[model samples]
Target chain A: MIGAAQLLPFSLLGALVGADVVSFPQAMLSRPIVAATLGGALAGNVAAGVLTGAVLEMVAMETLPVGASRYPEWGSASLVGGAIAGWHPVMRPGAINHGVFVGIATAWAGGWSMYALRRLNGVWAERALPAMEAGSRRAVMSLQLRGLTADLFRAAIVTAIALLVWTPINDYALAHWTVGRAAAHSILAAAAAAVAGGAIWRQSHGAAGSKWYLLAGAVLGVVLVIVA
Target chain B: MTASDRAPTTIAPALSWSARIAVFTRMFAVQGSWNYETMLGPGIGFCAEPALRELPGGPDGPAYRDALARETRYFNAHPYLAAVAIGALVRAELEGRPAGQIERFRTAMCGPLGSLGDRLVWAGWLPFCSLVALLAFGLHASPLVIVLLFLGLYNAGHVALRAWGVSTGWRSGLRVAASLGSPLLQRGPQYLARAVLFLAGLALPLAIARVIGRRGLEIPSHDWKIALPLAALFAIVLAALLVRLPARVEGWRAALVVLAVLILISIAR
Candidate 1:
């Protein structure tokens, strides 16, 4: 179990990665694969983090953050998921699945939080409207700085709240898990693959010359599988 | 508000490298204030402020204020490619171009840059790199290696786009459309999409194998022989469902509910 003291740094990382989503550099660090893995490291279980991250990534592929389209915020959500998964670092029944559940839920809520932030920004922009109209450099800088600060705080709050709510549930689920290990692993794997399948379909659906590439890649994949 | 501020745009003296770099760096934060009203308008203003400081009023002057006001006004563009708009707009302001022309340029640049970056980065390159990393995970790569590989590969293209974008926009000014015609912008997404589709095919199988095989985590007494056939069958079925699942189905939500139900049942037992 993570102690109360450890939660601060964990939540802080969550804030940084969360801000990276759309606030700061927009680097891929906010990505599920990276964020989860980082969270795993923080929790002393890199493998656990990667496992959760892999599952999250498959579902996240379906989400494209194109201009203004509402999509789940995966950065902090994945971190929460990764931390939960890495806490015990056991690949046992009910371990990873619960984490993924928590992550998906956080991401869904994070999307709404982002929408709210947009409105809050509207309010701030309204306040700065006069100075902006006067072409004040201070006004522009102030708005950007305030917006950036608010987003960071938003991610931190979302992350802290998710961790508080989900950690005990994850522990309980893992404690009470009764399914055979094989079945549990198989079920989670199947869910992940299914999500990947949907994502792959979306990627290949209407693109020109994608079928050939997919086929060629499949052959290469098969050869690699057989060779290994 | 004056004739010169609204005069027809002409290529003006080159922006000092210092000013150009300042604008470039600030462009990264352009989406910080993204909102419903102006979308990226305020951010655009933020980035343009440094350059506008060079106006006769030196940040407090009428010329600076006029250009800053117009530049910062409502605007939208892809975050990565926004440097392009910033670069061009800075050049136009320095040249004392018409307000309407700068406004039109700002409006015109958004759709193309947004779609172009979306196609190039989001739809194309992002998934391609992710699939590569996924394959590495399947193959049991170390955590650091997998992360470094993904970030290094993804950011190479990401940083390059920004580095090139601002400069390109500055040089081309109103002629920025020509840059879009380049093979990298035009055909780049198509190639990346094809590669991503292929990588997706390659990675998915291996990932399924890892999942069912319980590879890497290497649980003791894991029988591959029994798991392989069952895993293959489950993979096919679930993957089909994922692909064919209707939009109406809230797949993730439903999955959560089902898991919750199962957990409750276990608790009851």
Candidate 2:
């Protein structure tokens, strides 16, 4: 029931943006920051939700989700992640560790779901190829609607599962595992850093000249932290 | 084949003014679950073919080619709004003009609009989203803030690109690029390069995520300052992977390499 409640908003957002990915007005609703915030708002933790979303946004920044290139479905992933993060007891009063973990796991699942749905979209597109080639605007619109609606259903299911399962799984794991709080937190931090590093490195690879930009961004980031 | 060989039904009636504009806008507006191949090529085909049939020659070989050329030129100028002016143009041609004038007009429009789409839509508007998203992150704003900022920025870009791309695709075609201060030839490759980089930027994050999963490493901070540098590092590694691949692998395969390395690192760790 909790999952269903959270999932509804994400499903709607995904349908809206996923449809927008190809249909209606092109909008940025699928973006992680926006999606996560919406998820957080629905979950009643706007701040935590946005925090988790921002992290996912940073981690997933390089994704364009254009064409056949499979990308993490931030629209749904952010929603699930934001909900989980916002709900975590440890995340209030500016503690972001629990929220971050939830965000990471949810975002990973979201990426997988996105890939799965891409395959589904391909199958549906093939089925609709005749109508697609028929030169009927309405026919093309129907095909687009079909794939988009399917995506909505897929995201909804994923969100519902994630939200329903997160707390139980988190408790079981936490109860079973005993590590220093710092160590456990460090591991999460390290993972986030590694992901961030990997993401940055990947982009820098594309533009060798962008090293300076990367360096500049890092220095600026550090400066902001020191000042804050 | 000569015009005489054409069937009588092939020469359909002209599209109305409103219809022309609709055709133009529909070009870019078609998207969501469909991939770029589907939307840009086949999707356009769906609208263009009918719009062509509604025209005098029913988008005859020359007409179809002309439409494609016009769309392509418009795409180049206003890559973001390539679809906006197409419907309107097709509608206008279908509605009928003096014989021999359509081709001339289409040809004229192709060059400028192509350039305009590239500059105004592709370069100008796309970067706007990045700026807003980046600023929000820098400020440590809430997810809602980033999302809202992105929405505002993207919509602004969208509206501007639509208005400008359509106007140029309609009025000057190829000259639209010139009006936007983008020389067609020189800017074309640069634009292509930029697109490649932007795509690379987008792909970098996912690639990084995969790598970290493989490496079993995590970041220590929830801040963008740390995140940005990490992203930069990931990009470089990706570039190196691209360089190291035996053959020139395109797209996702390259991402796979990054994933492979990440897994190796994870195992090693």
Output the number of the DockQ-best candidate: 1
Give the runs in model 1 whose Cα sits over 4 Å from its true position. A1-3, B1-12, B218-235, B242-269
* Best-matching candidate per lDDT: 1
Clash pairs, model 1 backbone:
B6-B98, B7-B98, B57-B61
lDDT of 2 by residue, B54-74 (tens): 543444445444443332221
Q: What is the C-alpha lDDT of each candidate?
A: 0.79, 0.49
Candidate 1 C-alpha lDDT tens digits along A108-184? 99989988998899899988999988988888888999999999999998988888888887778788878665665
User: Please, what are the lDDT tens digits per residue for candidate 2 over residues A11-38?
Assistant: 6665564434334455666565677777
TM-score of each: 0.93, 0.62
List the TM values for chain B, per candidate.
0.87, 0.47
Question: Relative to the unseen true structure, what is the C-alpha lDDT of residue A150 in candidate 2, on a scale of 0 to 100?
Answer: 68
Give the lowest summed-lDDT range of ten residues in model 1 chain A.
Answer: A180-189
How high is the lDDT of residue A81 in model 1? 85
